[model samples]
Every structure is written in structure tokens, then in C-alpha cells.
Target chain A: MDDNLMNKLAILAEGAKYDVSCSSSGVERLNNGKGIGNARGWGICHTWSADGRCVSLLKLLMTNSCVYDCSYCVNRLSNDVPRASMSPEEIAMLTMEFYRRNYIEGLFLSSAIEKTPDDTMEKMYRTLDLLRNVHQYNGYIHIKAIPGASSDLIRNCGYLADRMSVNIELPSRESLKLLAPQKSFEKIMPPIENIRNNILLYKDERKSFKKTPKFVPGGQSTQVIIGATPDTDRSILSVSEKLYSDYGLKRVYYSAYMPVNEGPNLPSLFSAPPLLREHRLYQADWLLRFYDFSVKELFAGNSSSIDSNLDPKLNWALNNLHLFPVEINKAPLEMLIRVPGIGHISASRIIRERRVNFLDFERLKKTGCVFLKAKYFVTCKGKYDGESLDSEFIRRKLLNKMDYQQISFLG
Target chain B: MMDYLYDGTFEGLLTCLYYNFAKIKATGIYRTDTYQTSLVNPHVAITTKEQLADKMYEKIRKHLGTYTLTDLYYCFLSEKDGFENILLSFIDLCFRNGPVYAGYHTHKEVIPFDDIVGKVKREVQRYVGYVRFKAVGDVLYSEINPEFFILPMLASHFADRYFNEKIIIHDAGRSLALISKDGKHFIMPYTETDLPGSEKEDHITNLWKEYFQHIAIEGRINLKLQRNFVPLKYRKDLVEFSKPK
Candidate 1:
């Protein structure tokens, strides 16, 4: 609560806000009756910031001082911002106090490279060590894995933290070279690969030995800045697809590039961040992860970017109109989910409820499906609610509804 | 048809249901405190019988299963107007058609019951994040004004998480508090005057406000979006939303 700590918290939080990976989910930890905290598998958002982002953790940096001059980063060495660092003791103390007051689920510890990668990673490791051992904090802890840090240091921190991430920064190696000459896929990929392999190794060991400590039990994730360079949505999503399949990541966060620093290589400071593009990428990413859609399916044709006017699922449905007018009562679960507005939850509910009684148009609405959208693609009990099977008509209707909603929202 | 009135408790409601099944068909069930006199319909005052309530509880569990029973309990906690009539018809339908009737999501009787239960569960989940604790001496204290009687539902989550710390989550609307200390917890009647005034700011809260302000991006200032997530109704007790004196 001192002035020095308050100033450091303000500066460091500002530096870490752009990282945009504030999830505390994927681990269900219980307090041992002696510990002070627990982790819910479904993460809890303590509050929302003015930017509408969830404040799940006390997101902070170990220090704002940097040696690498990444053009996209506000904490680059060339920037003239206030620099402050928190000691391991200070970080641990703050995390405990905030967590005990229920202000946060846990701590999200990230840092700009100070002195060296190993030095920065070591300081972060000590903070986790003190929180987990000395304080017996059983809460969630997500720490950033420094890209160029030694594997030993990364593995040590892995055992103490619930989740870890290494930012891919740019979509492609070419963009990385242009914007951040010091950082590359070569430096970032190794830590991600190492964390993935160690997670598997630790899980297998835990089955054999119950006392084996968890190595990033919440799994590893990575982030890529959107619209930083000339990276297309296709390239970004392909990188994400590779990370999910090859590296076995839990999430791939796509951060809209906010131009905090002025550089010849970066976008203009006056240009708005491509927030809608980032949202479309997230929608496409969900389709890839949960909806069984491939990157090839999302970008089926010559289009290299996602449709900005509609969601990826709806766009895919519109493109593949030959598959529409699906029989709601007879369609398989997989086929049912492919229908627009029918999510996995509603699709399963339809399967379950239909087993007891045949579903009618009225019954399908109660199953939690968005009838307005699904009516265009599905028929219930041989009754089609849509006026026609024309995709153009449906698209216009949906777009008009969306425009109305947006106008009301602005008003 | 006669109206039945009983104490405002889950067991009392079950007892009223038992009486309706045993003696005569009732037009509706009303809580003793909230019951209004009607000129046309005769009313019967049903006494609370724990044994009869237990019998009805076991009957519901045996016939409709624990899932429906849990939903019914949550619906009772919602305290919505005309909820007793909704639950009565829902139970009547379940008894006639067996447990499968509960799965009839589109049924007229089941729809309102599900809506009320869903609202109660959503409020409990929201309060899990919205409850703000303050350090009142050695004990941590928080006050929440929830729409449902959700204090009992929130007991295990806070008790399990803060097992070592003394904590009290007060439901100011219901005048009840969930108090936990040293791995044990209980819900008891508590009033606002029991705790000191919480307007005084501490340095830790000041530090949190500072961090909250600095965490938002300057370029993407979206107060409307923020209001959508943390609505104005919930800002009454949040530390970051409070203005400094």
C-alpha cells in the first residue's frame, strides 16, 4: 500500500495489459484446508475493466524495463516510459493480499526482458516459488515463458505455475524479422515445444507416481498480434491450427494490435486497431477448435480473410447451402451442429429431447436453439419455417437484423 | 376450490403439497406472510409438519429423480410471484407422466419453472464473482443484495476457498449471512448494523483502484461494453467502481 508499490503496480499493469491472455481456467484445484485459495475449472472473472475485458487475475509485470526493442511493444528499450520492477517478495505479498480479499483469482506474472532472458525468467520463477511454497497459495498462477530463456528455468517455473504461454508475437517469420528483429519463431517455438513435451511427460509420470508435481497443469497457450504487419487472417489461423495440432496448445489468443509506439515498420498510430478483424479470427478459431471446422473450410475459396459482416459459422453455412434444410428430428448430432444457430449444446439437447417425443417447430425453440437463425437451415416435423431455401434472401434478412441491432446498440 | 397458506419455507411448501394430495384439491398455495385474502375462494391454514414434508420430499425424489428435485428446490428459492402455482402444476404433470415429463422442455408448466430456476442459478453464479470482501479487523466481510435466497447456495464455494480465513458473506436483502471460519461454515440471521460502516477506504483498495484504472487500454475506452458486463446494479459494492472521497 506504500506509494512506491502503488506506482510500480500502475506502470507494470500498463505494460502487461497488452498481452491479453487473462484466463485462469483448465485447472480445478482445491484448498487443502490449510491453504488460502482454490482454482475453479471454469475461471471466475473478478471484475471487468473499462475496455470490457475480464479481470480474472491480478495481471502484472515483474518489471517494465526492457533490453529488446520490439517495435510493437510499448515497453521496448527505445520508449521513454516510467520503468519499475517488483521484487519476488513484493509480488508474492501483493498476490496473497489481493487473493485473500477476493479481488482476483490469482496472479498473472509477465515481464518485459530486463537485463537478460534468464534473469527475467529467474525473477518470475522465484515469485511463483515463494507463492506456492512459503505462502502455500493454492490458487491459479499463470506465468509467461520467456522465449529465449534456458529450458531448465522454464521447466522449473512450469512445476510451480498452473498455466504458461510464449507469445508468437507476429504471424509469420517474415513479419517477425521486420517488426521485432530481436525476436523470431526460432526463439519462441522451442519453449512452446518444450512446455508441450514436458506437460505430457509430467502427466505420464503423475499416473505412475502420485506425488509428481504438476507441470503447467492448465496447459500452455500462445498469442499473436493481429494486423501488425501485412499478415492475412489465413496465415494467422494456419499458425494457430499448427499450434493446436502440433504444439497441443490449450488456447491461441489473437490480440488486436494497438499501436502504442511509433515506428516505420508498425501501423500508423492514428489508425484504429482492427478489433472486428480480431473478433472474426476468434470466431473462426472457435469453429476450428470446437465446431470441427478446418482452416481450409473457413477459407474454402480464394478468400484469405474471414467475412467481416457475419460470423464464420454462418458464413460457412451460407456457402454450403446445399447442406441446408436439415431435418431437425432425423439429423445426426454432427450434422445438426453444422446447422447455423444450432450450437453443440442445443444440438445435444435436441438429440436428447427427441428420443422421448417427436419435435415440432414449437418444441425446437424450447431446446435453446436460436430459432430465428436455425429456421433458415432446418425443418421440424416436415415443417419449414423459412419462406424460401434461397441463401441470398436469408443473408439479406440476417444482415438487416444485425444492422437494426447495431443501431439500437449505438442509440 | 380452497387456497392453502403455510410458512414461507421449502418444507412448508412441501407440506402444503402433501395436504393437497391427501385431503382436498387446493386452488393455489400461498405463503402465510404474503397471502392475500380473496372474497370468492375459501382459504385453509396448513401447519408446518416436518414429517409430512419429509414424506413429500422422498416421494418427489423417488418419482422425479434428484435432478428434478434440485430444480424444484432452486425454483422455490427464487421467490417469484405465482411460483407456487407453477411448481404445483409442474409436479402434477410429473406425477402423472413419470420422470420423462421433466424432460418435456416445451410443456407450458415446465417452461416457467425452468426459467425461474435458471434465474436463481445465474444469480448465484454472478454473485460468486460480484461479492467484494473487505478486511473488517481480522475477519473478511462482504455484503450482497441478490434477487434470490442464494446465501445457502454460496456457502460451500467460499467456505472451501477461504477455509483458513474468517469470512462472512451477508445477504442484505434476505437479512442472512454465510459465516465461515476454520473449515466450518453456517448461515444465520444477520443485519447490516452488526458490521461497521464500510465507507472508509483502505490503502489496499486504493492500490486496486489504481491498477484497475491503469489496466484498461487508452485507445479502446468502451464504457458501454464495461457496463454490459459489470452492470450499474452491481457497482454499488465493488471497490474499483467506488469514487474516492
Candidate 2:
């Protein structure tokens, strides 16, 4: 490659590194035989970063030059950082080159508002158009939906991209106004809601036609910058709950606020990022999506913040001591999944495996349950392990067994 | 007590099971290659008969569905120590209870077989993600040193993914290779010298290595997480971990 292209790539990739949404799953598009690449149902992580995040796509920005000056962004317009912008053709060529080398699954193109939101969005749309129509690249492409861009431009970009995201960087409208004055939830929520309605509409169209082009088949996701503002966990999750219920979002990403720029509105550089809180929110999100958990169940009586020592599921189990000692052999599938030690897959396995025989402790252990943690709350063959139903002792025992400080990237 | 022994092929195992089921009152069954020799007990070598193996397999498929039988076959592929005895006992239970034993997860005899099958399936699934292909000339070549005999299991996956290109997946651990061309694939006994690196292969490999090193975040360096995802055992064949040729 030429020196100009290389310089642009280095700056653009570095600028896009902290977005933390490089996933390439939830859509399976077969290569049209003429196309160069295909998207698998389960996304392939070509490699991992040193931080252990999966690098599935060539995640990069179209340009770092911006018109809006967000306080938390590295590519804020007022910053003195080096700025470079790739033309739509240059970005398309780079994606094809990287993809052919098997360096990435596809493209994750996000950009700062260079001239205006519509101007920046049109540049991104042209990049996607060239990749899809001109280059015939049929791989996974995730693009950012510029919050203030026109509905027509957003709809056009949604047609060509596999997934679209509009980041709710700050939790509340007040935070958006105070820090990111140019952006607001009014501008952000409209585009997200539009994509959701269009995706549903396109699904209905394709049911009869059978050849209609997919409109954001992977669905839309939004990211919230946690710990940047004074928003509580309850408030954050409530927004997520509303997003899921009203907008039908596929995912809501939580990014622990990594201090990037210094401003009076932003958090101090000395404070650590809330990595543990982000992880707990993800665990809670999984519960909502797969484990049939309601938002009210988590914050029903006293707590809004997730317990740091135990996982969200275990924490909930310990607090509701009246619901303990659930019978493993006879508990329904929904109740079984609510158990701390039994995950979605294992709970299903238990349901499947228990049909033919009466389940005992050994059988439950063999079914992939976290047998040690589960022994306290579950009874097999009417026999429980703990001497008493003392919640504090059980909590302490679990804490002694698990080191909550050590976080797994699997979460 | 009598001991029945046979070669370690699946057919050999089936033949041994057949003999114990029909001809002999054997106390224990063993694969002759893996079992230690002992002068205390009398051991008889059982020759594999294709017809008898076929009959035993038919009986198994009749008692349990093909899904359960495939699970048992995967357990056999695991090649772990004393897996033959476990298979024999599992098959015996299948015959006695006529499908209840296979369905019942809590049965003492069924749990060990379930464990082995689960282990084999997990290894197979991991290799699906862990297998990395290096471009050598027109063929996309990858070499794996998987713990299980998983080359056969990986045939349909790679074939579907790379339908237009010729591909070869070599299992270096077992000296086996599954080669596909024109959308068709099959496995054969392979040696080290079968694959010849293309001229530009080194350049592409270096490019991949460059991308791998630069992609990791400097602020959040977690070797523990990296090791957890790409285990040290399978890193030998991975392009990021391997030294350039």
C-alpha cells in the first residue's frame, strides 16, 4: 500500500478502537457465487487483542475529523490529535484487501461528523454502497447510524449494512445536553426507532416476495458509556429495558467509561473504569434475554446496584431465601434456569435428561451444573447439602470459593 | 477369569464385543495394542469379522436411535484409555434395557459414556473455531494437532465454508489429512512431506502475524484471557503463535 493509505489506516483504526462493539454474528448471508465472502451464523473471531476482545472485523473509522465536540471522545473536534479521512473508494479497497487476506471477517465502519452529520453519513453510505454494489462484497458490515442524519439517508444505509448502531453514549438526556451539547436523545432515538420499524416491515415484505433484499438482518444495537455520568445502574438498565421492550433492540452494549479526554464534565483520569459493573450488567442482560428475567425482579425491594461478590443470579437467589431448596427432579424449566448454578444450556439439558430417570446429586453434577454452588439451593431426591438455611453462611462460603476480582472475558 | 483382546479399530472393537456377547464368558475385554501384557491371565486374540461387526452395529441402531449410536461412535473416536471397556458395557446395557438405558442419563452405566461423548463433541466444536488455514498456492491448507480424531468431523464444515476453493485439513497429531477439491472431500493417511508451501505463503503469513500483533490493546493486556481462548496446546499450528518459516 502507499504511504498515504497506510497513514490513514493507522489513525482511523486507532480512533475506532474504544467503541467495543466488533461482534459479527446474528446474520447468515451466503456468497452469491460472484461475491468474495460469506457471513456465517456464528461469527468467527479471526484473532484476539491483548485485552482479549475478539477482533472479528476490520473495525476502523472513515475519518477522525469531526464537527461535533463530544467531551469523552478522542476524536472531538477541539482535540489536537492528528486527523485523516479516507475517501469512500479508499475504504472499500482497504476492506476488500484485508478480507481477501483473511485478516478480518468484514468491515465495522464508524466515523466522526466531518462536515455535517448528513455529509459524514453520506460518505459512510457511499463506502457501503461501493463495497456491496461495486466491489460485490457480501460479507458482514456494521455501520454507525449518525443520530442527526436524515431518515432517507439512514434508511438507504440500513439497506446495505448487516447491522447498525446508534450509541447512547450518555445515559440521560440531561447528560447529553450538558456534555455533548450538539447531540440529544431526541435525535438518537428516532433513527433507532426507524431502523426497528423498517426491519420489521422488510421482514413482512420478504415473506411473500422471497427475494427482497434484507434490511439490517442482524438488527440494531446501542452502547451506553457507563460511569461517565452520575447515572445509577437502575437508571441505565431501565433505559435498556425500554429499548428492548419498545424499540426491539437485539443488543444494548455497556462500555465502562475509559477516560479519553479531560474536561470539567467528564470523569477524572485517576478513577478506574467500571469493568466489574459492565460485566455484571452483561450478566443481567443475558438473564433478560435468555433466562426470562424481568427488570422488576432484579430491583424489586432494596438493591439497584448488582452485588460485586456474587453474580447477579446468585445474588438474587441469596436475597430471596424463601424460594430456596428448589427440587431438581421436579422444578419447571423456567424455575430451573433461575438457579445460580444452572445456566440456560444446562437447565435445558437437565429438563431433557430428567424425563427418563429420577435425578440425583451425581446426575445433576454430570449434567454440567455448577454443582458446588448449586448444592445449597437445590435438592436432589429430597436431600439438601447445607445443614441450615442460613443466607449469610452460604454467601460467605460462595465468596470464599469464587474470586470475584478475576474476570473472565467469556462474560 | 478370561480376557478377550483385539486390535484398536472400531471394527475390531465391535468384533470383540461380538465375541463377549456370543462366544465367551470373558471377565474383561481389551485392545491388544494398548493393554499391558500379563502372564497371570490367559488372553485370546479376537480377529475382526466385517459381517459380525455389521450385525452388532445393526443391533445397536435397532435398540437405540442413530443419534445415540453416533454418540457412542464418537466416544470410540476419543481414543482414550479403557474406552473400549466403557463402550462394551454401554452396548451391553443398551441390549438389556432396549433403549431405556440410552435415554436414561442417570444410569450408572450411561453416565460414563455420556461424559466421553460430550468431551469428544466439545473437542470437535473447538477445532471448528481453532483450525486456521494458511494459503499455499491455490489450496488453502491448515494443520491441526487435535486431541481427538476430528479430521473426519471437520470435513463438512470446511467444505461448506470454502466451496469454491481447494482445501486440505491435516491432522498432524494422527498423521491424517482430509483433502477437498471441486466441492468434494475425503480423508487419507498423510505424512509430513505432503504439503509444499507456496512461494508467497511466507509473505501472507507474515502479514497475518503483523495484523495479530498490532490488533491487541496495549492498555488492557491480559495473557490469562488470551491463554484461556487459545489454549497453549493448540497454539503450535496457529499462525499468530507459530514462528515464520
Candidate 3:
């Protein structure tokens, strides 16, 4: 490894330390008949990262010498910190070496603005280029696309990478202006639009050739930092819901801000992006994606923004009481997902597995499910174990529990 | 009856097993290194003879499920000493239960056996991410003593992945490997080598210098909890926790 390569890797990797996109992973790392291993899980499987993300991947930065002055970024040019840049050859070689010994099954490559926008993008493309062409590495690779890169570079990146992301640092353009003054909302939209169109083009071609080229086969995703600026979870989820609606993005990572590079404009670390707020946004976002709960259906309800005390599902279930008491044996898959404690996969599994037998909590638990909160709203063979249907009482109980967990942090 | 032993090779091992069932009392056995045997038993080193192994396969197949036998093959490749124990356990399980394992039939998907394999795979994973190698001269080394014969499983994880950088992952338990890059790998009947454990310092950065101090919020110093994740055994090998010379 060259000195420049090591330097670049250190800067960018240190810069990427703040991202929390490790949990929302479905990408399994498999070998191509030559590499070391794959990411197959077992019963009671546990994973851990530097930040307790617990999933696997060598999450690092491609470079940290950024030309853009995004106030939220540690690698912004004005900041006096050591910077490094990795050549595609160096990056690919490291990934292969680590992969052979099974340190990780994939690479999460992100970079800062170095020199011109095109130069930054060219380096990112070349890294993926070397990983694929020279090394024959057919593995999980998630690359973060710099917003201001040329259209050609963006398209080529989509072709080469398994997943691509462009961080929408703040929720609204108004907040973006206040926090990240150098970044414009307009500069962000073009890439999102281009990736969306390219994904669609690849899908269309796949129907004809069956061997049509893969373009972001793992799909596009982006992150929006929470608590960095004055954006509500309500507003953030709205933007996230729209990103999903418009671009067909696979995931929108919500990073809870940890008051790292604090200044007068930034929020205090004590009152930073409340970790629960990030959790609530993920719940509400899940509602939009899998539960088919619309933004209006979520916001127009009396209890706007998810309940701080109860989970988002419980909050919604309490708000809309009449929708509950649905039979688990009879309810549609959509209604099942809306039930508290019923995840998308479990709900679908319930629908499939129930065809042979009338499903009970016994079978549900066997398939990795908890019906603690769900029992109140759902009945299996007319067996309802929870209390009366006063939404207020349930709401109060849920809130009290949340308050207990939040304040009991000493444990 | 004569027992045979040979340098580690699947064919050689299979050949011994084959003729042991065919030529004499079908009782000839193979062992890796020199050792004593019963007065009635004679021993010799064996090599790959296709016809002998093929005939043995025919007889073993008459009474053994092909899938169960293949699993035995994969498990044997692990070169773990306790492979015989597992083999006995497997043969016992098969005779007692009639090859109820899902992998027995090519058609009926046996998920539970695969799930056990999956459990073993996780052990391989924990070994990979968690193994800490001590650097010595040009090479890095770490010794793992896993419960099962995990050498074959661990071979690809360390060697092929670290192709450019040379590293040795020794199965301290079985002394076996599944390495791809040309390097020293073996399994043996116990010998002694005083491994240099914590000799490398001043070169690698002191581990836990930043993460332990900076990870949690300022006031919450949960040493007990942190220690629980990183056990005491590993600390003895870590340079950060070493007593000042």
C-alpha cells in the first residue's frame, strides 16, 4: 500500500465513523467460488460494529479531503485535519485481501469532495472498477455518490455499484440553507432523478435480455442526518416518504446526531436529535413502505408525529381503534402489518403458514415473533388477552412505559 | 488386521477405509502419525488407490445414506481430531433414527441439518472477526482452539482473504487448516511450541486507547459491561492492557 493510499483511507474512514446505516441491511455477503465466506446467520445470531451496528461490512471512507463546506461534515476543506485518498487499485486490493480472510464480505465506500467534483467521482468509480474488473469481486458493495458529479459519472457509478447513496444532510431546503450553506437542494435532485431513471431502464432491459446489465442491483438509498439542523421527525419523515415515493429508493438511513462538531448554530449535545425520534421516524417510514400507511393517514390523525411514549404502531393502533379487533385468521396482509409487534416478514409468514392450520401464538413465536402488544388489537380463535378498547388508557400505558425506559438510562 | 496411516489426503484416508472393509477383516484403520496399537493389530502408512476406495464406497453405500456419508466427508476434511467422535455420533444417529436428517434425500429439503451447519458457520464467523493476530517479522499469527474441527472452515477465512499479506491461522485444537495461499498448515498428534504472544508493540497502535475512553457519554463509565464484551483472556494478549515494563 502506498503512503497516499493509506492516508486517504484513514481520513475518509475516520470521517465515515458517524454514519449509522448498519442496521437496515438485507445484503448477504456470499463468495464467488473463490473468496473466503458469506454472511449467513444462525439462531440467536448477534453482530457488533464499532458503534454497536452488529452487522458486517468494512465501512470506510474513500477520502476525507472535501472541497464542499458542508457544516455537518468533519472532512469539510476548512477543517484542519489530516486527509487521505485511496486509488481504486489500493481500495480493491484491501477489500479482496480482507474478504479472502473473511474480515468482511463487502465494502461500504463513501468519500469527501477532493479537487474537482468529477475527480472525486472518477476515484469512486475506479475503486469499484478495480474491485469488479481486476479482482473479479462479485460481492456486496455500497458506494456513496457525491451530489455534484457529472451525469455520466453518476450513470456509470449506478452501473458498477451494488448500492448508491447521496446524503440529504438536512430535511428541508430551508434547514439545508441554515446548516449546510454550500449545498443546494437543486444539486441533490438531479442525481436522485438520474439514478431513479437508470434503475428503471435496467429493469426494463432485464425483461427482454434476461441477461441485461445490472445497474445498482441492490438499488439506491440515501441518508438524512437528524438533530443537526432544526427539522422535525414529522418533516424528516415527510421528505423521506417523498424520496421513497418519487425515487423508489430502497432505504433512507436516519442517523441520530451526536453533537460531534458542535458550534453556536448547532443544537446542544444534551438536547441533540433524541435517539427515540430517530426510532420513531424509522417506525413511521416502515408504515409508509410496508404497512401501506400514507403520509396523510399518518399526519392527519389527531396524535401527529409518532407518540413519544408508545411505539408508532401502538400509537396508530390507539388513534384508530375501530380498525382493530380484526381477526388474525381473516385480516388482509396489510392490516396484519399495521398491528403492533407484527413486522412485515412475520405478517407475510403468518398469511402463508396459516393456510395449513389456524395460527396461534405458539406457531408465531416459533417463527421469531412477539405478540405482546399485538394481542390487544388481534384475536386468534376469539382469544383476546389484553384489556378494554379505550384508546386513551392504552395510550397512557404505552407513554408511561416509554418514559420509564428513557429515564432509566443508568441501567 | 493391519491399520494404515498416511499424510493428510482425502483419497488416502478413503482408501484405508475402503480396503479395511474389503481385503481382510474390513478392519484396517488409518491414523496420521506414529503411535502404539493393540498386540493383535498391525499398522502401516497408506496412499490413494482409486479402486480400493471405489469398492469401499460401494459397501459403505449399501448401509449408509449418500447425503449422510457426504456430510461425513465434509466434516472429515475439517481434519479436526474429534471428527471421529462426530462420525461416531452421526453413524449412531443414523442407525438409531434411519437418516431422518433433511439432507439425506436429494429432494426433501433438510433445513435443520443446514441450520446446524449454519450454527457452525457462525462459529467460523466469530473466529474470523474476533481473532487477534500477533505480528512477528514478516508474518502475522493467531492460534484458535475451537470446540469442533473448524480448521477446514477457517482456512478460507484467513488465508485466501489475506492473499497479499501473509498470515497463519493455527487450529491449536486440531493443528489443521484449509489454506489456499502456499503457506505452512498442519494437524498433528500433540506437540509443544511456546508461541510468542504479546511481543509486538511500538509498531501497531495501542488498541482501546480511544474507543474505551471516548465511546460512551462522559459520565457513564461502565467498566463491568465493557469488560463483559471484551473478556479477561484477550486482555492478557492485548498490548493496551499489558503492564508497563
Highest TM-score among the candidates is held by which one?
1
CAPRI-style class, candidate 2: acceptable
Clashes of each: 0, 1, 15
Among these predicted structures, which one has the highest DockQ? Answer: 1
Q: Model 3, B146-182: lDDT tens per residue?
A: 6556666566545544444456666555655333343
TM-score of the second chain, cand. 1: 0.92
TM-score for the first chain in candidate 3 comes to: 0.87
DockQ of each: 0.70, 0.32, 0.08
Write candidate 2's Cα lDDT for A1-411 as tens digits: 455666667778778888888888999867666656788878877666667787788888989999888898889989999999889998898777566545578899999888888999999999999999998888889999998899999999999999999999888988898889989878888999889989999989999999897899999999998888888788888888888988889899998887878899888878777778888899988888888887778875866788766788887888788998999989998889988899987887787777777788878888778987888898888999866777899988877777643544333
Candidate 3, A1-411: lDDT as tens digits: 334544455455567766555432444444444433343332111223233343345566777777777667677777788876666776777676555433354777887777887888898888888877677776567788878889899899887777788888788988888777888889888888888899999889888899787787777888888767767667888888889988899889887776656566787656644676777788788888878887777764444466666667776777688987878888997788888888877777677556645766565554445666676788877776668777876666656655766765334
iRMS, candidate 1, in Å: value is: 1.5
User: Which ranges in model 3 have alpha carbons more than 4 Å from their true place?
Assistant: A1-10, A22-47, A84-93, A135-138, A262-264, A300-304, A329-332, A344-368, A400-403, A408-411, B1-245
Q: Which should have the higher DockQ, number 1 or number 2? A: 1
Q: What ranking of all candidate models by TM-score puts the best one first?
A: 1, 2, 3
Candidate 2 ranges beyond 4 A from true positions: A2-7, A29-32, A87-103, A129-138, A400-411, B1-63, B98-108, B192-207, B243-245
DockQ of 3: 0.08
Ranked by lDDT, top first: 1, 2, 3
